[model samples]
Target chain A: MTGSLTLRAGLLSCILLTAFLVVWHLATRGAGVAVEMDPEYAALMGATATQGVSAMPGPLEVGATLWRHLRDPFYVNGTNDMGVGIQIAYSIARVGIGYLLAVAVAVPVGFLIGMSPLMSRALDPFIQVMKPISPLAWMPLALYTIKDSGLSAIFVIFICSLWPMLVNTAFGVASVRKEWLNVARTLEVGPLRRAFLVILPAAAPTILTGMRISIGIAWLVIVAAEMLVGGTGIGYFVWNEWNNLSITNVITAILVIGVIGMILDQMLARLARLVTFPE
Target chain B: MTTPRFISMEGIARRYPAPGGGRTTIFEDLWLPVQRGEFVCVIGHSGCGKTTVLNILAGLDSPSEGTVIVDGQAISGPSLDRAVIFQGHALLPWRSVLGNVTFAVRSRWPDKPREWVEAQARRFIALVGLAGAERKRPAELSGGMKQRVGIARALSIEPKILLMDEPFSALDALTRGTLQDEVRRICLDTGQTTFMITHDVDEAMYLADRIVLMTNGPGACIAEIVENPLPRERDRTDLHRHPHYYTLRNHLLDFLVTRSRTFRDSPPPGYDRRHPPVVRPGAAPQPVPVPETGDTLPLAQFANRRHP
Candidate 1:
């Protein structure tokens, strides 16, 4: 039953793709009459004016552009013209460093909050207030304080990634089953050892789930943050393509962003699976 | 009497603040002594604070009022000398069977080498009949197997006293029976002093040397301590056929079903809180009339009836 369902689903996806492509092809088949004009004038008028073509690129045009980008994904053709791979790599690296920094800070602090009622209650107001503000809202403050545009982009990722993980780690640690804690208590396991041995393992799956959520948010925020603090990233690439009126390139960047985000989410999903227990 | 009681509870009471204001007592003025190598089970209805008494003995919780002295030292908190087997088989899900046992062994003897810890853990795991399943995580194991790991982990610590809170209550009947037998055999072989809280009267009878009964709570007391009349070598399959089996079973059942509630409101006349009466139901000397406060019979009357 499952196999047949999967087969039908795959067939439906292909049908949908074909239908979408057919619609795109028909929609962008420009109907305006061609006005014979000077070659230099036509060049100045851009590709859209050549034979009165529509400015919007069709699926075929987008597909060709995607193939070209794939061919030399990591090419470095000066500041404004680096390959898609390089731009994606820049975004990933920023998210990676920022997310790791968040992990380092959030986990221990979260442990403290989870383990102690005092800290949890004490910091709850700050977390509650800070968590809802958009990471992009912090972009101006980050640029002013940090001074580096690249670092500012990373700061947004860090801020965006921090809360879910911190909240999750705290919830996970605090809710560890009383029986397990009692088992450790009766064994006379010291506080530090008990934290590492009992609480850490028990809370790990929840912590990883928090991490997964944070990474997804971080990935989403990095794109917009990169567009704001434009140096070199997938988000910047999309904005740059839009400026150049290269609709095909922008669409390609969108696809790449989606794929990379999925990969990032999948990596954390695998890590979550590793720590999750059957019970 | 010179060698201090192996374990002693002196006027221990547990209370929680009520929603309105005043405290609600779970149990109060509780006093009991456990000699070395004794297997004692506390049997009571759900609300009678039987677990509270066991938790106090394990030092997992503080008594609102009294002190628990184990092997001479007054317990302020949990100690390495006491190990608990929890009802939920609280094995660390991430750890394997061997890993769970080794974790306890290492906690008890922090100075021991890794190999020594593993060896000690393996010995206890084997003792619980889980020798070949060492690498299996708690999730992969059956309920009975998980509980066996719990028992193995408790015994691995080699504590002065074992505290079990319905350790086999989660298992099926057959599994519980087998685990009970295994626990009894291990406890007997090691001469381990244990305090367990259970609702199963038959389980208490099969495993406990003395069954401590608590009246129903909100303000509970030790109703009486019933000495197990069956021999140490009693078997589960033929346990019912023992001459004193039904008498002892009926006594515990009667207390749980009827007496536990009534006894809390109206304790026997001349009932001493400091020294609750110990009765060996099938072996009571005679039908002694209820006595007034000063006319109470000495504990020696029932003490002489117990088998060595």
Candidate 2:
């Protein structure tokens, strides 16, 4: 039942996406008339009239583009373009590193903050100050400090992803029921053991939520970082396509970036549910 | 001294800081003594520090004024020898019904095989009528079942003294009765000392060998302790049918309902309990000293009062 329900929901979303795209094209199709179906506009769209297609390639075109990107990939990737898969892998790898680092550092720090009032009060202002800064703003500073573009991107992702997780971890640990702590004390669980087996597992849901939020921010920041760093990533690919006047590739990259982000977020959501099933 | 009383709270006084700036004394000069294999219920109105007293016994909190000695030793913190059942079932949401009880047993007895721990947990689940619910988590169970799991978990260790803080106050009448019966039977079977805090008048009259009633909060003192006149083995359904049930119930209700309201410093409506009237007052006065547990009331005490 769960599988079928999810499948039905997925199909429904696709249908809704088609309807929305149709409406979007209809609103903009008349733009072709305004520009007289100019050949310049069709540089990547392949002369809309010649292909017997609308200026904006219908749902079928996007679907074909998506399928080709999934199966054959490169030959269909773009006009003078890097493969969409490579662009996606670049961003995912940076996010993976930055997210892992964030978890490694944030979790321990958060546990201490939650366990000790002095630590929480002391570190709270620093966390509050750093969490809200824009990732691109950090890119220039990181680039100057690290003197390496790739590492700077990683640093940017790390900074962007750190706080949600840290704050959530602290909150989760703080909210662990007192009775459970009493049980741990009764069993003679030491401070470290209590943090590991009792408090962490008990607060796993909240911590995972923080992780989810952090990963999302990390993914978003990597895009901004790649654009600023001017490197080979999904963000760079979109910028490169725009500069080369390949509008189809740009649109395709936009869709791919969104879909990949959705998948990553969904994976985190699934992990959260698995840990917090409450049974 | 005095066989250590199994569990003794000698002049325990807990005073938590009041809001803003003031010390709120919930309990002061409270003397609680429990013998092994006896069941005692601490009955009081809200904020009487019954739970505070229970926490001190469980070693989760300390008394500001006195010591809580358990098994002839001072208690510094929680230990396996004493188990506590709070009002809400605190079962870990991530674990299964069997897992909840098994977690306690496993932590305490790491060397025990998995099968043994699981078997013991399953037995407790069945004892709480959750045989088919071994894999179900706390969320999947009803409120009563969750509390039963709490009870089963407490009993699983076979702790020497079980501390219950209104464990059944939230349940409806039917489930409450069934679980109360189960609790009585289990205590009878194990002979573990129990100290429970509750507000139910009939419960205090029914289960406890001794019911310690406390005054109002903000200096909640142990006003009186009533010993149940009936035997522990008496049929619960027919318990109130005994001639003395109404009398005992009314006497306890006076302390909990009437005395509590009057203790708030409000003016009384022409009632004086400090000195019993020579002639019968408007309301028929209850007998002063109800007979203690495991003892018969003298004919002289009952002679002054009628069953009605």
lDDT for B116 (candidate 1)? 94
User: Considering only the true interface residues, what is the Cα RMSD of candidate 1 after superposition?
Assistant: 1.0
Task: Give the TM-score of each candidate.
Answer: 0.92, 0.83
Give the lDDT of residue B169 in candidate 1.
86
Model 2 lDDT tens row, A126-241: 98898777877887788889999999998888888889999999999988888888877766666776787789998899999999988888878787788887767888888887
Give the lDDT of residue B287 in candidate 1: 28
Q: C-alpha displacement of B299 in model 1, angstroms?
A: 17
Worst 10 residues of 1 chain B by lDDT: B294-303
Interface RMSD of every predicted model, in angstroms: 1.0, 2.0
**Model 1 spans with C-alpha error above 4 angstroms:** A1-3, A31-52, B2-4, B285-308
- Cα error, residue A19 of model 1, in Å, equals 2.0
TM-score of 2: 0.83
Kindly list the per-residue Cα lDDT of model 1 for residues B203-297, writing each as its tens digit: 99999999999998888998888888899888888989998999999999999999998996777887877778878878872323344542132
> Which structure among the candidates has the greatest TM-score?
1
lDDT of 1 by residue, A147-180 (tens): 9999999899999999999999999999999988
